[model samples]
Target: MSEPDPGLSSGAVVAEPETLHAPPPRLSSPLARLALDFCASRPAVAGLAVILVVAVAAIFAPLIVPQNPYDLAQLDIMDGTLPPGSPSYAFGTYWLGTDVQGRDMLSAIVYGLRISLLVGSVSVAFALVIGSAVGLVAAFFGGGLDSLLMRIVDIQLSFPAILVALILLAIFGNGVDKVIIALVIVQWAYYARAVRGSALVERRKEYIDAAVCLGLGTRRVLFGHLLPNCLPPLIVIATVQVAHAVALEATLSFLGVGVPITEPSLGLLIANGFEYMMSGRYWISFFPGVALVVVIVAINLVGDRLRDLLNPRLQR
Candidate 1:
């Protein structure tokens, strides 16, 4: 047969063997590769660095702070209204100066950060749990449940979040727990909307279909399968939402409808300092404002980086 095909092809032409090309190396895991890509990017790296520093500061505030802002015994009435460059105060010591209550501005900022971060984190966690549950149920069940849930979300969205928070605060009275409740109530809808959209898409994927075919319970399919896939967006949203929650808490405190007067938030500090600003005690509010800016800015930067890292289209 080979001899016969020398002049003309018997069945098919016998062409020279084509050069074999080595296949591209496979990534160990998509997530691992994505993480590497983010770390390598400048903005992502910088954002991560800033967030790390802030986190470190927050975690070690008790040890790192020069004074305990919360301990009234450590305070001095004469230290109140000290200017920024007072010789006794020192540079980083009174880096921000003292508040009207003679609390070290730097220490106040550190302690304030603890409160703000706590409120923000707890509120975000609460929102995530509630939102994810609502979204999963609404999307998985669909029909009237979806319509009803989404309608409520829409109605809540119609009002400003701060207004809703204010109303809740008024009803609940001022306290840390009340502030958290207000934040959770106002912020959960955002997560619900995001999760619902993602769940709608995920519920129709091949894996979900396969799971359904295998007789997996709806709760398992929704929680075990769909939830994991919906996390990337949720993580980014949660990061940004924490900043918002912190700001909202500050706003509520400033409005005198937030944390107790004994435990002043950054907002309360700002509000209190407003009176002293003309009296030359500028550090009280200024330091807290700066602290707030740093925390929020750092969080936002990290959130933006996370969004880029998680979104395939945004990956470089």
Candidate 2:
């Protein structure tokens, strides 16, 4: 053994070897953390990419697609039902072909996606607002009012969402606004139940008691104090519900009780092509069906990943 340095004090202690550990990467904000979490999963990233592509196509359909599927003046009846890759006299190459009305399949699919997303998003927003309000009021009060509200939710929940939507549509007649209203009525019950559950737990927390003790109004106590804490699960539900609303709207449209003929959706496009499937005109329905599946699957992937990311138990 080597002798210790003579200059060192008897009570002095030598330092241990330093371990070479890298510092954690800095996350600038909550959004940055969410972005990192989202990118950590390859499937979620791919789903997001697909959603972005479809959304972009839908948003810029008129600029990108060669023909305007919705414009009567742009269509030529002679070109109707052209097969994929067929040559069009008016628009050069019809890459995805034309429908029965001589509308380009690609353009129609993009426009249909636009309509589906629009209805889905708007209905979800309306449902969230209506449901959250009902849930907050019920949970915050916790009395006969809660019992009455909950019984209504229970009755609505007993029926299938599609069945309820169909019944409402039957009574209201078919149109975009009517379809949205039907979807909201069908979906609000779900959000109401979810929000009420979350609010029930949150209402007992210290912050909620403090807010109440501060003489905050009922609106402030429910909306401001309780609602924010209950939002994580609501966000996850909203993402999944939007996909549900889209599929439900498509089903209603396919059954001839959804959007009007003037405003076509993927469901309507598929329905239009159903009669010709026995012939060789498969591309009409096939392409639209694929688009619908892709949109639904992509949204589901994102929603599932969000559920995992947001849930603490799942994180463990």
lDDT of 2 at 62: 80
lDDT of 2 by residue, 135-155 (tens): 999999989999999999999
Stretches of candidate 2 above 4 Å error? 1-22
lDDT of 1 at 311: 75
| TM-score between model 1 and native | 0.87
| lDDT of prediction 1 | 0.84
* Tens digit per residue, CA lDDT, model 1, 1-316: 3355355657677665555555667789988887777777676677678767767887898889878777777877887777665544323456667777787777777777777888999999999999999999999889999999999999988999999999999999989999999999999999999999999999888999999999999889989999999999999999999999999999898899999878847888888788888777777788788878877887888788888888767766
The lDDT per prediction is 0.84, 0.91
Pull out the clashing pairs in model 1. Answer: none
Candidate number of the best TM-score? 2
Which pairs of residues clash in candidate 2, taking residues 3 or more apart in a chain or in different chains? none
Q: Which ten contiguous residues of candidate 2 have the minimum total lDDT? A: 14-23
